[model samples]
Target: MSRIVFLEERCKGCRLCVEACPAHILRPSGRFNHQGYEIMEMDGQCTGCASCAVMCPDTAIRVFRSVKIRNTAGEGAA
Candidate 1:
């Protein structure tokens, strides 16, 4: 699983993230931000590919990938 963070205040609501997301997980908010632009947020379907992050001109979005842990005992048993 991965974590997606959206910085609404910094967003310009240009829909660039939504358009760049390959999974189509990002959506426009119904309410506008202080800048009067519709905010963009990631939904549950996000794959964490960072496509949106790369496309965002304002650099308001961040994607964090979860680290996988391996059991040392299991490796010894193998």
Candidate 2:
């Protein structure tokens, strides 16, 4: 699983991240932040692709990827 964090105060409500997200999980919050701009919110699963972070002009988005560990001994390998 992936996690996305947004610095709402730094966002300018440009919607660039929203359009850049391939997962289509980003959307406007319909409310303004401290800067009086409509902040972005996540509404779905995040793939940790960093599309939104890369597209964000204000660098308000952050993506964290989960690392999965598999048990090799669980299979018939021995």
Candidate 3:
């Protein structure tokens, strides 16, 4: 699965990340951070592509992609 973390205080309510997300998984949270700016959050499917993070001018977005593997015994591995 892919995960996106938005650094609320570092965000300035710019929609750059939203526009950059190819997966269209980002959206405004309708909530404000300590800086009084609306933050972004994940709202849909994510392809683990780093487009959003790369387009974030404030460096407020972090993307983590975890690789899950299954063994022949049907066990999950990290």
True-vs-predicted CA distance for residue 13, candidate 2, Å: 0.4
Candidate 1 vs candidate 3: the lDDT winner is: 3
lDDT winner between candidates 1 and 2 = 2
RMSD of each: 2.0, 1.9, 4.7
Q: What lDDT is obtained when candidate 2 is compared to the true structure? A: 0.92
List, residue by residue over 1-78, the lDDT tens digit for candidate 1: 887888878889888888888888889878778988888776776677898899989999999987778767756564
- Model-by-model lDDT, in order? 0.83, 0.92, 0.89
> Highest lDDT, which number?
2
Q: Which residue pairs in candidate 2 have backbone atoms (N, alpha carbon, C) closer than 3 angstroms, thus clashing?
A: none
Better TM-score candidate (1, 3): 3
Q: Give the TM-score of candidate 3.
A: 0.83
lDDT of 2 by residue, 11-30 (tens): 99999999999989999989
Q: Model 3, 1-78: lDDT tens per residue?
A: 889899899999998999988888899999999979999999987788989999999999888997877567745655
The TM-score, computed over Cα atoms with residue i paired to residue i, of candidate 2 is 0.87
Name the candidate that leads on TM-score: 2
